[model samples]
Target chain A: MQIETGELINITDKGNNLFHLIIKADKIADKALPGQFIQVYCSEGESYDPLLPRPFSLFRIEKEKGCLELVFRVVGRGTSWLSKRHTGSSLKLLGPLGRGFTDPREFSRVLIFAGGIGMPPLFSVAEVSKEVDFTLFYGARSQGELIFLERWQQMTDQIFLATDDGSAGQQGNIVELASSLLDSGSADFYYACGPRPMLKAVKRLMAKLKIPGELSLEERMACGVGACLGCVCRTTSGYARVCTEGPVFAAEEVVFNE
Target chain B: MNDPRLIVKVGQFSLKNPVLTASGTFGFAREYNRLFPVSALGGIAAKGLTVQPRAGNPPPRLVETPSGLINAIGLQNPGLTAFLQQELPFLRELGTAVIVNIAGFTIDEFAHLASVLDGETGITALEVNISCPNVKKGGMAFGIHPEAAARVTRTVREATSLPVWVKLSPNVTAITEIAQAVEEAGADAITLINTLPGMAIDIKNRRPVLGNISGGLSGPAVKPVALHHLWQVYKAVKIPIVGMGGISTPEDALEFIMAGATAVAVGTAMFHDPYTPLKIINGLSGYLDVEQVGRVEDLIGIAHKKDGLD
Candidate 1:
């Protein structure tokens, strides 16, 4: 991993409080993978009020243009400060950190599940693997919360969306939609990134169907490296750091906490 | 025309500089080495080690307060045997001082660890962690009491020939009393101000944020407390002090040095920016040049000089 200062090239309001930021970081963009993330130093300069760097997964890696894109929502102080940054401002970034997803080309048919903000990394998977046949199950709280709808529709061979309010595709959650649509041998491999409840439900369903898959996990992090042991999740082996051991892990390896 | 002298002598051992990475914050020095050269710093203290591999506390182990972070990592480490076989060889090649911080649940555990690590080639000193607030037993328990603190120090001192620096807790009523007791009990030097005990509640969840319920507080919020304690300890003992807590910038490190610390460790601030120690090293050289000071050691305890504003 490398620390590089990247200029903010573009910032787009994806609507409903979501934003897409593209940074010009040649080294990070060149090294970053589908599910890997970058730690964004949010403090303006020497200020230590917001004391830790915030982690954001790679939404799109524009290597040819020497740029990296991140999709984030304004949740707390760090992201709030990040959202207000101007395009010309420099952003200090540490990345291409963490283990990312496996190569999608390894499987003939892939199934993807994305929940709200979790869509960024999975969206990257769909964007890069054009040769693989992908079926996507994307969900959000409502039609307004859904982002990159057009891009996702264009990228995947088949797209399924679920909204809690029934204002979009399916009326229920994404896991319910996936369960109703998929059966044994529906796909060779599956991938998911979402809220814990959804991931837990998906893990159970995938086990019942006996399909191998990977899950992207999230935790509050410091150091954004393996050192601190701050961001860890319970796995079959033990508590593994989410920053280094993964933001991605085998579906069966993860043991969700109650 | 020559570079200002950055070398600092702590007891019999001399460090290349005054900036050392704090234990628990810097895990084995492998992570930050990927970003910058680790050999430039004065010293590195590996994570606190125990007799057995600990899984540590449960998740949600960290919470960020105003300008501080509360963490109950519960001294998670690879245990003593793993360190010798796995981490020590890598540390030896770093071309810097390696100070091992040992945490024990009992006095024998502390002595055993020191004895085993005594003749190790790369290790410069043994830092007895009597001040860790996260663990359930034998950490701050031995630290808060002067007699108990001295007993731990005495045992480690008797077990090893290496210079023993006892790290003291800031949570005590009389930090100087504990400092004096350890010094009298044969401590070669002192490392002051392990994190103060703190807790954060998740208001919506109506529960404690950390899995251990309470954790140790570190970062900028504890700077004043750490410096005050360091100043008091400096006056009470002749042993050199390694002052640390909320030290992020060069200015902060200078404050600790002026307050009579031969060295300072950067802890929580490293989590904010891994380059913090390197930045402070450069900043110190710049400060010395501008101030016309010939040596950093000359400035140690200058704030305590009776001629200054007293």
Candidate 2:
């Protein structure tokens, strides 16, 4: 993938310090599938304080408009810098990278487990695929942290949400909700992206239930490509690059904490 | 000539320009070719290889600081045979000088690597990694002792007909002594300084961030230290230096060059910006032309003379 410069087309404040950035870049958006991410250089070429580009999964791709949207919360130097980028600012993107979600048998009964910032890529997947009707489990620490609640409500009939505090939906966690949902054995295959603990829990629960699924993982990456080898995740085979080998892997392949 | 020349000579190797990606940062030179053809670079120092495949350290292999990143990857690689079989073929197609960076646990392993790769075609030189701070064994242990460092250099030097580039560690008290020892041991060139010893703590978890506890710190945070060490080693030894540590921009590369580096390597910067080497390379070309210098070699040791040092 070429590192192309895209002009910031629009920036929408999605409230709760979450933002939806629309950049008019064809190279990444044209090839970008759901779950693949772009490494964004938050500033002009000279800045090194936040020395690495932050990886943002594809939130939405407007193919007709030739623009892709990235959703992120203002958490640190990189995101804060990205937040201030105006419509005319130049943004560099290195992507359409990593393996995107595979349909895997057209997954008629799909279960998506998304937590906090993990909702975007799943959102993109739900937006594109009409092949398999799916249920979405959107969760966050609180209602304020939920990025696109209205959209999730509109997307599918089966949207299960959980918040840590009793601000919204069930007052537990997403992995627990996923486990309870899996107990019924409704989902044919599942997809997930979230905090590691939640994913580990999901993996364990899936293993216990003898279910098969794919997970979209997040790691602190330097190069969005495999060149850096900085972002690594343990697997049954060996170490795999979270950037190149996957931001998506079979749930069975990953070896979580004991 | 009105236009400046960017070619630089390091031992028997003649780099089209003086921009080599530091070992361990650029994996086998294939990954970055997807973003940009690495042919524009002067050279590629392929990832640090061992005698056998290493799985590397556990997860939490990396941490980010203010202007640096500490990675305790533990010299993970597919080993020498795997690299020769799987990696070297594609590396040869890149059409740039490929310098293999080899890490060994013993002087004999080091010599064996050099001896084996010596017969291998398409390798410009070998960067003997005696100063990897991330691994628990055979890494920085050889680098801290000048005698041990010289032993590795001498052993590898005897084994290989190809030029040997000894990579030195910054963790030692006196890097100059080690540089001198390697030079006397028949090293053709030197790459300084490898990452400095560092660690980060997760106060919330009440433990070290990296699985290995500590790793070598690289990036702009280590540039000043790298620059200082480069200057010290430059004054101590007569061999050409492939200076690198935290180099991100053309100006940073120029700093290393002015400090007496024959050429500069871009390491951690590659992590941040994959095309940083190209940026620095183009920037150097622009710099030399703007300054009306005929040769990049003129830029070397300029800072030393500016301080009125002999």
TM-score on alpha carbons, each prediction? 0.98, 0.96
Backbone clash pairs in model 1 (N, Cα, C under 3 Å; residues 3+ apart or in different chains), count:
0
Q: What DockQ does candidate 2 have relative to the true complex? A: 0.73
Please give the DockQ score of every candidate, comma-separated.
0.83, 0.73
Q: How do the residues B214-243 of candidate 2 rate in per-residue lDDT, one tens digit apiece?
A: 888999999999999999999999999999
Which ranges in model 1 have alpha carbons more than 4 Å from their true place?
A: B1-4
Tens-digit lDDT string for candidate 2 (A1-258): 778899899998988889998899987788888888888987565678888789899889877777889999897789999999888998988888999888544767778889898788888888876566788888899998887788877877788889999699899898787776666477778888888888888788777877688888887778778876778998999999999889999999987877
Each model's C-alpha lDDT? 0.92, 0.87
| Chain A TM-score values for every predicted structure, listed in order | 0.98, 0.94
Clashes of each: 0, 1
Question: What's the TM for model 1?
Answer: 0.98
RMSD of every candidate to native, in Å, equals 1.4, 2.2
